[model samples]
Target chain A: MSPAQHEPDEDPGAPASSHAVSAPGAPSAARPKVPRRVAWRRLSTISRARLSRGTLLAALLTLVLGLALVAQVRSTQTADLENLRETDLIALLDDVTDRADRLEDEVRSLEQDRSRLESGGGDAAAAQAAQSRLESYQILAGTVPVSGPGVSVRVSDPEGEVTTTMMIDLVQELRDAGAEAIQIGPARVVATTWIGVDEGRLTVDGQPVAAPYSVVAIGDGHTLAGALAIPGGFNDSVRRVGGEVQVTEGEELVIDAVHEPPTLEHARPVPPSEGR
Target chain B: MIPVLGLVVGVVLGLMLQPEVPGWLEPYLPIAVIAALDAVFGGVRASLEGIFNDRVFVISILSNVLVAGLIVFLGNQLGVGAQLSTGVVVVLGLRIFSNVAAIRRHLLGA
Candidate 1:
């Protein structure tokens, strides 16, 4: 379109002159062979332009392919994260299962030991030895059921104002007062149970507590009551925190309960002669 | 022209030799091949730029080494270090193909 571009078309060396006919209606002499080489060179130039354009298209395709690969890598990373979480869950479940199996084996062994002792001739010496062994096992199990006359402290709110921390603190006080086998509501208290707020209610073992938490202990009832009555005891703390704690005693407080603890799966059975 | 043809033939041979070998030697082979290709490409770029200097060659070599090392490190950290080291192989494959094509077109120009 520019004047400078038109000047090239008019140039004698230009490729356009290879096809140029001089006058519109007059017969012209045949052209020499030199312009034919120019035409071939021009054709080569056109082919080079087409090849360059094709290369550009290839470059564009390569870019698109790289982007698709990046998307695939991101999706794979997400899947890997999910697999890690599943691996953790499986490991935890395996641990719990292993513990349960150990407990089952211990129960089986104890039942067998007891049966052996009862079936064996009731010699005084053997009975004494077996009783001693049973006592030792009970101590090791942390579940030696103790029954005696002691005080039972019941803390509750008829209007429901008791907090979980208050309940935990109260349990701690009872524990300090030498209460064995403490249970709040239906959930049997253990060493590792984490007491926390669940929903709007105070809960242990996933069970919600209604009012009046009954806490029973097997010890000297008078001594236990005195211990709670002392300053900084559960009663004092409860009163200071505006919570209720009441203590009473009876001739006998039986804690007829059994805690089936977790079992171990992979441990070989302990030889009876090997003592810890 | 013979150098270009030799480079092409060497790359083809290397690609053919890859899978038949064990994995422990695999990493070194690809890295060596890539380094060699990078040197060849640097030579061509330097000739085009018409200013040959050791500095450009050194920088190119350093960059190639760093990039290849980083890719391998990332692959290892992502837990597919051994199995999917083919990522490095694929990149090398693309580079070799493009380099061979470029050399061929230049030698057989319009």
Candidate 2:
């Protein structure tokens, strides 16, 4: 539109028109010549106007596209489960079920042994020794069921902001409150229980535990509740991270779930020192 | 020259930041990138031919990205996302190849 811009526009057209005139003699030029000239003229006219804004817009968009591309590649690379084939998913499910069946069989045998120990005839001293041993084994192995006054904590992470670290802290807080036994859903927390994230869900011993996580702790109900209710405690932490936690005292809280004892691959138990 | 500098900066920022794309947008990203690539190649070809229109280049880039993403999204809703994505890629790939060929012919005179 400006007189200054029109001067350069006409300058480029002079050579193009001269070339068009000289190219008419060629046999192959006739078919494509007319359209090519029109396109050439139109492009020069448009490129001359508002050059800076257009180039900047294109650059910004390309930057965004580049960022999205790199981000997507990195995300897909890190997310292993998303790449699983149908057969792989099925195999994974089968493996989990098999493990569950084996654990169930172990639980059945442990229960039978517990019943026999209680009913078998024995002298009072021998019976008392056996009872003590059973209690210790039950506590360590997380096999025997426990029922006592305690607190139940229900945690819900609607936004998935709660990490595995937060869950571990919650469990630790319960233990610090003198919790003797704890059950998270069907999985019992033992000395060796591992908490981790699997497929975007919290997992205890490789078993996925969904949100609205129920935590039952066998301890003094008031003490357990107070620990979680303390300032900057587990409940406060969950709330800070866009999650919810509810704690309630109960007269009788039962945790019957058992944990699978880790099979030892190394290091046998050393005999107690004789001098002691 | 400016566009090339922009591209280099874009690539560097992409590499250095490594931001995480949300889960819902993952499926559409690669297709949109391919479409943008086609537009860039076409722009290069136009510039070589002395017919590069800035407005046309920007409009084409925007529309190409949106349309490509839309096609894939519709395909996903219809349960044919993978097939349609292949179709979009093949078409855009051909466009890119032809545009590159034009640029090569203009610059190298081959």
Candidate 3:
């Protein structure tokens, strides 16, 4: 376009307005004054109006440009987790595995608890079952003194000839008759009780016993008495050893002797939710 | 004055819209943006040089973005996306730098 409106030194900022003379910075101070009407006329020119229309269209395209830019920035920040060292990746994998393990454990425990709760028939039934089991353990373990309908045996050994073997046979005979508890002399008889002779003394679990030994068994009284009187049984064995055996059936025989239950050293309960 | 005003309005509009780019378009967006930036700088430099043409400026920006995106897409199909993207970025970056330098020179008269 011929550079028709040439000036000696046009201000850079004055180009967009297309009126270098109207520059407000250095030129305004140097010249002191310029016609505001002429400046306005130059601004309202037809060529400038045409350029303005084209600029509007160009700026519309920039809208897409701006949007794309922001989206790219956002995507970069939030995703693209692929870039990492191997150790970091492994650590992330480990974290995920640990979380999965914890969730699996929780799932297993919840499933077991749900099944137990459903089958237990309710709070009352569960409590009753627990109480029954506790009583059984107490009696079988000889941790508590037990009284029930059973039979009592009196051995009158005037010759002091009732050996440990005879006493053991009597206890075995009582157990076979469904006897839940037994007391021989001053000692309580349990699964772990030992009848042995120590220093030539008839000892029941390390305690010496004298003549006239009384054995109390808590079970069906007739059943225990019949077992003691069976042919070639506890009565025959004691009689053969020159000891007189007297068996008496009673409804309320008491085995007041109690023993300490041994503590477990190595055994443990298995986990209920093993497969899960 | 109007051109710069239009650009500012476009930026404001883009911010307000914040539209989501589709999956297919994601890979090429960065390339396209860089190409558009190159065109914008060229246009500004040309305007400072008093050789600014409305049709040329518009066509340059539109064609630059499209051609850059197309190149990246073709490179992806040929399994050279990474290399091609780097090459395209380097060329566009050089052009943008030269244009900006020219713009700076024009503005400062240095």
Candidate 4:
């Protein structure tokens, strides 16, 4: 027994090796109140203190643990899917299958629409399916001027009291009343159209148009005019701003403004399939 | 602490090598690592209790890893590889948590 290790405090927890004790059962029965510092000292001084078989094997095993630990950590944390349970993987596969089935159903319906339109297009119906697709595209793309039975709205605001809200409300009401094609102050109101205020001027798609704002919407003229003149509706909101609301129902309203088709750097029409 | 240093050296060696695990070893590697962890926790607890036995530690570590890998391999043969792998991990994970808890109390005297 070394006199230094018998100082009671250091010896109590320094039994990392069997050689540190006279009897194997003696150390466990001794004082168990020592700090972890003694154990730390016992382990830290392993090369100088003692090299028992248990300590040696423990060291070797710890080294293996380290290698395995890092390897396992990297594997689990990486994009590898090895850690997932079979049930979890099955569930994921099932979810994907469900999504694919839903997409197939949607494709089938779209294919049905195409077949109806493409009774005989000399090409597959993918790119051309729905009835009135050409007219719809022209109207939505704003590539061609449109005309039909519709209503014309002219609001003259001498005081310039008309705000952007009134302008948007006017267009929204026309849309709700089934206006198929709408033109507000030389700008065709397509899907990408925006109504906002810039420098205290009402802007349609970033282009400012001064009052009196003339809006022509091609749709059912009777329905558009009636929707605008509804009590306390768009007609009242314009008059509330001290602007004159003049709505005229025409059998045919012409909207000559055409928007330049957007140039495509990425998207291109997929070519039609033969003998769909 | 010196044993911990051994582990650190082992970690550095592993990182430097970064050897790709063989395809057959891929499934078993993670299982073996976790099983080895259980053995490590038991060893640390035994060391603190002055009951660490090198022979027992070595046997337990080897058996744990082998048995875990075997279970996964058998499951794959039976068309339930994923399920059996889950079973091994759950059992080993439970054992590891309990051993770690013991080690914590032993060191902290809590």
Candidate closest to the true structure, highest TM-score? 3
Off by over 4 Å in 4: A1-61, A101-276, B1-3, B14-23, B75-94, B97-108
The TM-score each candidate achieves on chain A is: 0.44, 0.53, 0.56, 0.50
lDDT of 4 by residue, B46-93 (tens): 556555556677767777788888998998899898778887787666
Superior by TM-score: candidate 1 or candidate 4: 4
Best by lDDT: 2
- Candidate 3, pairs of clashing residues: none
lDDT of 3 by residue, A1-276 (tens): 111134322222222323322221223233223244433333343136455556666766665676677767666665555433345678999999999999999999999999997877667877989999999988888988888798888999888778888888888889999998999888999877898887777888888877798888999888999999999998998888798998888888888889977788987877889835
Evaluated at residue A254, the lDDT of candidate 2 is 91
Candidate 3 TM-score, true structure as reference = 0.54
Q: For candidate 3, what is the DockQ?
A: 0.19
**lDDT tens per residue, model 2, B1-110:** 44555667777887898787777777788898888888777776666555555667777778888999999999988978778988999877766665565444444444
Across B1-110, the per-residue lDDT of candidate 3 in tens digits comes to 45555556656765677566677887788899999888777666555555466666677778889899999999888978878988889877766665555454445533
Q: Give per-residue lDDT, candidate 2, residue B49.
A: 57
Q: Judge candidate 3 at residue B12 and give its lDDT.
A: 70
Error of 2 at A3 (Å): 42
Model 3: what TM-score for its first chain?
A: 0.56
lDDT of each: 0.53, 0.74, 0.72, 0.73
Please state the error at residue A128 of candidate 3 in Å: 5.4
Residue lDDT tens for model 2, A60-103: 77777667667767777887876454457789989999999999
